[model samples]
Target: MIDLMGYADRVWTGQEDLRPYFSGALREDGLLPVADGVWMWAATGNVYVFRTAGGLLLFDTGDRHTSRALHTAVRAVTQDPLHIAVFSHGHVDHVLGMDPFDQEAAERGLPRPEVIAHRHVPRRFERYVLTAGYNSAVNGRQFRAPGLKWPTVYRQPDTLYDQQLDLREADTQVLLRHGMGETDDATMAWLPDRRILCCGDFYAWNAPNAGNPQKVQRFVAEWSQALHWMAGLGAELLLPGHGVPIAGAERIRQTLLSSAALLDHLQQSVLELMNGGLTLDEVLHRVRVPAEMLSKPYLRPTYDEPEFIVRNLWRRYGGWYDGDPAALRPAPRAELAAEVAELAGGPQALARRALLLAKDGDLRLAGHLAEFAALAAAPGSAEHAEAHQARAQVMESLAADSPSFMAKSIYGWAASQSQAASRGEEPGKEEAGWAP
Candidate 1:
């Protein structure tokens, strides 16, 4: 068995890299005891188990893919009936693993665990059902998993609270508070007696995922506020929705506050620029998280980048109008591409220039020029194939250069599409099979 606590201690002290913990590579197949009576099963999402005289309390069941495994692991540790399963949010990964638990209760003639979450969780489920197809496509593009399907059927919360709910299982006291962060329906569970905090996706080991480009709006300012709120609680043990458990009160405090500071800086900077009558583009270029903050191992932009966070802040405050009058009612992309190609001496010239720009490490400009060339050229023509090949190379370069998972996935998808176009095959036809 891997000494997860020792590993976590090494990671917290900077003696070990956080990648193993973050990727769940160090996770054992069974529940790992985190405290005297607290156990955590780390999967794609972390499932925390709290043993009490009443029963067992859980925070954020594992994802659908690991649901059965999680149940088996939890059962291996204890036969205690599940008392309450608290969903940190409505995201499928955090809430979909209750099926096996529910089955166990039925087979054993025990009462089903009461599901609890914020009031907005059901609304989030409804929205998921409404945008099932769009969610499927975007998630597929984000994770680089072709033909990924979004689950419309959700395990709704049996009990919902607006602000806070407190529960007592014998001597233990668990406080559930609603907060807006990565998702509006986020719940933070506090175990006062044990001085442990079950913070959902709010404090994932990587940078705060407040600006996932492919998802719904995230609350940046509110997210920082929630982090600050958690920091103030003086948690001795931090059990996050993902990653290994963090020990030590001061270490937990510093980690939470540092993450909070990064988000606060970005939010305030964006707000300051937005208040100054700057356009979204101008604000995006001006606002930046400090290099020192990004250097923090826990705040690295491995999943979501700071630039995307700035854009999300703008979207939250400035709405869809990016202050670009031309963008307010833009010309058809193909028409504009044709006009630009004509100015540049045809699609062939544009493609050659794009390849040249790519060679010079100007991937952003190269991508634009290559895409325009491909759009302007006649379909099935030699020029079209040349332009698409250029586009594919540029996109692949962009993917290679990106440190963020989201950016890399998107650029990779774009490259895949361009590769198909270059081969004279229909783009996105492979993806159509999974469309709702």
Candidate 2:
């Protein structure tokens, strides 16, 4: 067994939840045996293979880029054909690894593995097809990997279930239950005989990703309830999608429950502020989770920040108004910037003030002031150059301080744009997709 105490000390440094993983020795193709017959392949998204008497059962096949590596890893374990493959959700990373497995099976004169997932997966595929280029561009910026393209080819699932699915492979009983969490089509697997629960992205080592600023609306209430249900199962071994597995019944239960409590706290806190007629910005400042809960190893905000979660809750319960009349029908950004600059004397003055704000560590306010200066100043002007440089510095600082990879990606992209503008280049618009 890996030394838990030493591993924890190396992995958890109280700064970033996943910094240890990136700095550690785990390679993309490395496979770790979590149990006797179950093994996990670590990558952008993990793949868990269960070697049953009938054949191999796979849960969440990694990303498309890691397909060959995944195939090599699986072949190292067993040559038994893949009898069944289940998608944990409709995300691109979880579903695109099917082609490699299918290709290998075809070469061996074997039938393709039967794919299974929730009913909503087909719709998700349709949406991906509709917005293939758009999703590709957003993901490129999100991961800071320029020109990363999303494939138009999707392997549709053969078996689709609504809420619950039960299958018997040899003597192993596999139960698939639908839970609304990171995605609407999220599925969690439970093995009764082995007492192992494979939770997809629902339980990451970092904080819950339900509050992603760039993603769709996550079901927070249902997600919290799902955690409670998983905790009640009394599973001895818990396998998550992105991180190491947890052994021992009590440890698994507490980890799950603590994660759920964090969600519950965010949900309740957001609702309390919304019911009091506070605006989204006001509620963002007011709703706060306890430091103790935030300090939990599994509850660190390394992917989704709490503020974004509050905005999602507002979108669900309070609608799109955000309780701010100015945002209902805002003026054109350039026009507003010109007006603000005029009121502040000139664009040069605004640029100077922005630099001062950035120096004072008010990055958020500095960003706004710098944008106004940039928009108001003429192209190739000294004020325009100064404004862009200040904005770039502010964005870089924010990116460096952020623990969330998503936040760092966006802020880094913003910094790049500002830097380009300072060079007098017409920086292209940010193609980041709209969050639903």
Candidate 3:
């Protein structure tokens, strides 16, 4: 138990260190011009607005807050109705602010801009309504779960492209290539004449978030292939869904190739282990990216952790259920907790050990011990109460030590829940961005 918990602690600590440094970027109003018929803006998430002879075409809309600015920026450029609005994927940051486009078009009696997305995107809309609770949990944003308020009255995509769709204007052709990266239904908008790839989230400047634990399996292979191919396109500019834009063809190609290299390393390493007939745990213990590879700015694990990437690859080649037999027909969480508690010399012993570990500067390990002991607790179990209290302290210490904002948020949230559990309180669980 001690060694198992220690490994989890190390893994999560590595997770804490994975988030890329927040370069203290200043937010700017959406506004950037490029080429004859193309423009871009970076509000919260980066959105590129292309000015075609037909009408205004928006590559991707930012989150809820940027809607007004998006409208303002577009109106400032041209009063033309938004002919087509493309969503890179079904991510919250990229999809929500599209309402303003609709409103602007309606006010002047123009036809509603056609919502263009991959086939699975409409399904995401359907599922958002049907499984609000499930969607909220997975979304992990502040607005999900308990107070989940997704976009309502979703206008299904009028134009759905299976593999690729060519959007040709007068002397301009923007190719919408379908490759699921951040989401199963991600689409990249390519401008041939402009030599600009408005590659939705497929080529995010931040650490690749393709391995979000709560989300669906990512097409790592497809994503790498897309980038490797896009790298050779000699595009002068690369517009991404999130983060700043990259200029210069050589730099752009290298950046894409480097991003692909990160995934390729992880994927290839996992494949090597799998081919060698190693168990999942054994592979996980040995899985490591070379220091040279991890040193890249783009490959940094800012948004998604590497272990999750390894685990995702395992699932891609493996099956739905993880390999453990106990997990196959597992006991209910409470029952398993109770059994583990009973076996670990009762909860009181667990609490004391956690206290020692916490004091010994092993807060991560202590937190896990406290979790098991705390969860197994019965209402009247004195052992449960003490364990939860110890758990809170350990988690608080861990939170204090966290190096990343996301890690701090996660550990702080967990500590708060632990504190609540100690007093037999229901810690008003607000679902957003929480893994467990």
Q: Highest TM-score: give the candidate number.
A: 1
**Deviation in Å, model 1, residue 86 alpha carbon:** 0.1
Writing each residue's lDDT as its tens digit, candidate 2 over 1-436 gives 3433344434444433455455434544356677888887776777899999989999988888788888887887689999899999989888888888899889999999999999999988988889887777777778777767777888999999999999888878999999999889989999988999999988988778887776668889999999999999999888888876777788889889999998899999888877787889899888888889878887888778877788888888888887778989999888899999999988878878887887888877877887788778777888778777877787787888887888899889888877888898765535343110
1-436 per-residue lDDT for model 3 (tens digits): 1122232234333442212212212224335565565666665566777777878788877778677877887787777778888888876677776788788778888898888888888888777677666665534432223454555446567788889998785566888888866678888877877788888787765556666666668878888988887887889878777655666788788878988888888899989998998878888879887877656666666566667788889989976665577788888766676787788888777778888998998876787777777777765566656877877777778868753334555666666766766787765545233222
Candidate order (lDDT)? 1, 2, 3
Cα lDDT listed for each candidate: 0.87, 0.82, 0.71
For candidate 1, write residues 156-248 as lDDT tens digits: 889999999997777789999989999998999999878999999999888899888878799988988898999999999999888778998
Name the runs in model 3 displaced over 4 angstroms. Answer: 1-30, 33-38, 141-146, 358-364, 380-383, 396-410, 431-436
lDDT of 2 at 150: 74
Name the 10 consecutive residues with the lowest summed lDDT in model 3. 17-26
Better of 1 and 2 by TM-score: 1
C-alpha TM-scores of all predictions:
0.96, 0.93, 0.85
Superposed model 2: Cα runs more than 4 Å off: 1-20, 23-25, 428-436
Off by over 4 Å in 1: 22-24, 429-436
